[model samples]
Target: MSDFLTPKATPETAPFWAGAAEGVLRIQQCDACGRHYFYPRRFCRYCHSTDVRWTTVSGRARLDSYTINHRPLRGTESLSPVIALVQLEEGPRMLTNIVGVEPDPANLVLDMPLTVDFEPRGDMTVPVFRPASTGSAEGTR
Candidate 1:
């Protein structure tokens, strides 16, 4: 009875979802062009070759941009989400949610270092970001 949206894993995205379910972040890398990409595709976006493979990423990133969503969709009103664009350490930018901190502008700073965290939605685990330096005696930078 969850209200969150769950992604349907396809042949091209099954590995990525499987990794996520196991608490790992996976991205598609183009074997031909040596470039990495997100949102799994059947072919390499850069080289136009069917040479893409799933690789586990470091789960580290920088907060590129974000918005605090106060207006929620139907059945999601209880959650005030922080939607964000994060640039992964491996060179791909992904649209994800920021968690483990306040959703206000005062807390969500640009270029803040982040680490991935997963939240279960239906049968899938969705990736979300958190302040990388959180939980340390020294606060996040």
Candidate 2:
């Protein structure tokens, strides 16, 4: 197993983890404000409404920013991880790893389109992003 720490699902975030296990990206939406958010909380980040529900998203996002991590977790040292912040189609920004491409500045362009994919960490699955272009080389990690 990798030395990377996996996320522990809580009552509020259980749905998100369950969706990822099923290869679906799930986030929370506020019924009252009609807005979506991430990090799994009981109330909406925008409107502070407790009428939030879990919903599956398109898994499409745009690369906003990133940093190439030369030093990764113990077992994942072979994979130079690209830590990225992506803006989802629903307007929520999520911190995820950019995969399916080289971990270099030229390859990690700003505003590049991305699609979600899951990576197994221990017994849990986590979301990762890949370049939208089919021509890009397959994921290195």
Top candidate when judged by TM-score against the true structure = 2
Task: Tell me the lDDT of candidate 1.
Answer: 0.83
lDDT, candidate 2, 8-125, per-residue tens = 8899989999999998999999999999899899999998999999999988889999998887767776443899999998899999888889888999889998988888777888
Q: Write the per-residue lDDT of candidate 1 for residues 51-134, one digit (tens) a residue.
A: 878898889899999988887787665443999999998899999899889878999889998998888777788888899875
Candidate 1 weakest lDDT stretch, 10 residues:
132-141
Give all candidates' CA lDDT scores: 0.83, 0.86
Candidate 1: regions farther than 4 A off: 1-4, 78-80, 134-141
* Number of backbone clashes in candidate 1: 0
What does candidate 1 score on TM? 0.88
RMSD of each: 3.4, 3.7
Clashing pairs in 2: 100-139
- Candidate no. 2 TM-score: 0.90
* lDDT score for residue 84 of model 2: 94
